[model samples]
Target: MRNIKMTIEYDGSRYLGWQKLGDSDKTIQGKIENILSEMTKTTSDIIGSGRTDAGTHARGQIANFKTTSNMELIAMRDHLNTYLPRDIVVKKLEEVPERFHARYNATGKQYSYYVWNTPVPSAFERTYSYHHPEQLDVTKMNEACKILTGTHDFIGFSSLKKTKKSTVRTIKEITIHKEGDLLHFTFIGDGFLYKMIRIIMGTLLEIGIGKMSPEHIDTLFESGIRSDAGMTVPAQGLFLDEVFY
Candidate 1:
């Protein structure tokens, strides 16, 4: 069998998310796997770097699958793209070492969130960015980002009800850049829990508008209660930027 690595991009507006579910076929993984199964005439299983939530976009999502076919790499990529929906595209594909697992070998990931800071929303950007009418204090938001960086228990920032796994995650950096009416937030981290970025973004935005303080972040870390943290922002604005190995 030959191991193939793929970089995928998709507009998550209509899909149910990345993972393939038993009850539904409207998924990124399901769509790609179906095509691969038909192409190679085998049940091909793809392993992704991580799962992006429903309606969450991805620019550089990584995945891999093993197949016994001897198809050329470029032919495989072109064939997949030719048949996949216009909204989803396989950006790159290549053969890799047999033991190279996409999920297990991933070292970190980068995610970006887009926000429209102006009072009037952009008609074209409605599906790509979060619209916030209230003026945000970027300086204060950065202050909160400082507290949010580093290793910490992020159970409060996730929507998970219960898990045997540890909730601790390391956020390498958090930055907000303003370009006209758009506020771009970038996060580089070793890993993140469910809805962690959205909740953290909500908290930072609340802090920006003076509804919360930067000092409160420490309290949430200690509390480990989901309700005490900020709301889970809409999934439309979040994008899985890149996965590192």
Candidate 2:
């Protein structure tokens, strides 16, 4: 058996997220599996490093599957791209050891949230960015980000519906950057709970708009209550930037 790993990028504007679900739903993983099955003349299981929510995009998502075909990496990539829908593409492909598992072996993940800090509506980038007309205090946003850079119980930032036994997660790094009218929030973490990044961004944006103070971040952390944090940002603005093994 030959194990093949692939780097994928997709514009998630139309799909129902990455995982395969019911027959009525269209998904990234389902689409890829269909194409692989057609090309190789056999059903194959493709495993992704992580699942991005509906409307969330990915720049460097990683996945792996096993196949017996002696197809070259370059040929397989080109073949898959030809069959894949326009919103998704196979960026790279390589052979890997049979023991590799995409999700189980992942060490960390990096995500990026983009906000367009302007009043003008972007015709092209509207699907991929969050537009805010109000002026954002970048300094204040950065300060609030500092409060989230270490291991902590992120119960306040996670979805209240989560049933996980533990809400504790370690954030290895958080960086805020701005260029022109674009504000980028990048987060690197060992793992994340559902909607955690979006909630964190929403809370920080409140601080940027002067609705909340940077010091309130500590209060939210201490409260361990979901209501204390800001609203969850839209999934379209979030991107799974990379998955590290």
Candidate 3:
């Protein structure tokens, strides 16, 4: 068997999420697996770097699977693209060593959140960005971003009720930039817990609106309580930008 690695990009608006669900077949993973299974004439199980929430898009999601097919990597990629939905595309494909894994071998990841901060609705970008009509204090938001960086216990930001695995993760950096009526946020980290990015963005939005103080982030970190943080923002604005191995 050969271990095949592929980088993928998808518009997640119509799908349930990246993971295959028992209740629904409208999933990113399920679609790709179905095509792959049909091509290889075998049950193809794929391993993704991680799952993105519903309506959360991806620019460079990574996955790998073991296959016994003799098909070349480029041919397999082209064949899969022909059969898969137009919103989903395989960006790159290659063979790797037998031990390489998509999830277990990942070292870091980066995600970006897009926000449309204007009163007049954007006709074209509405579906891709979170629309916030209120004026946001960008300086305050940047302060909150700085406070959220570095290693810390992010249990307060995560939606998981409980987990045996460690909630502490190292955030390499957080950046906020603005262009026109749009605000963008980028987060680089070793890993993130469930809903952590969305929750953090919500907290930053509240801080931007003066509803929460920047120091509130400090309190949340110290308390480690989920309710102490801001609301979990909608998934549409979040994107899995890149996964590093």
Strongest candidate by lDDT: 1
Pick the winner on TM-score between candidates 1 and 2. Answer: 1
Q: Number of clashes in model 3?
A: 0
Predicted candidate 3 versus true structure: per-residue lDDT over 1-245, tens digit per residue: 99999999999999999999974778999999999999999999999999999999999999999999999889999999999999999999988999999999999999999999999989877777899999999999988888899999999999887788899999999998897888989999999999999999999999999999998999999999998888898898899999999
List model 2 lDDT by residue over 1-245, tens digit each: 99998999999989899998966348999999988999998998999998899999999999999998988899999999988988899999989999999999999999999998899978877998899889999989888888888999898898856565888889999998887788888999998988999999999999999999999989988988899899999999999999999
Decide which is better by lDDT, 1 or 3.
1
Off by over 4 Å in 2: 160-164
TM-score of 3: 0.97
Per-residue alpha-carbon lDDT of candidate 1 for residues 1-245, written as tens digits (9 for 90 to 100): 89999999999999999999984879999999999999999999999999999999999999999999999999999999999999999999988999999999999999999999999999988999999989999999999999999999999999998889999999999999998899999999999999999999999988989999999999999999998888889999999999999
Count of clashes, each model: 0, 0, 0
The reply for model 3, stretches above 4 Å from the true place, is: none
Clashes of 1: 0
- For model 3, the local distance difference test gives 0.93
lDDT of candidate 2 vs native? 0.91
User: lDDT, candidate 1, residue 156?
Assistant: 96
RMSD of each: 0.8, 1.2, 1.0
Off by over 4 Å in 1: none
Mark the 10 consecutive residues where model 3 has the least summed lDDT.
20-29
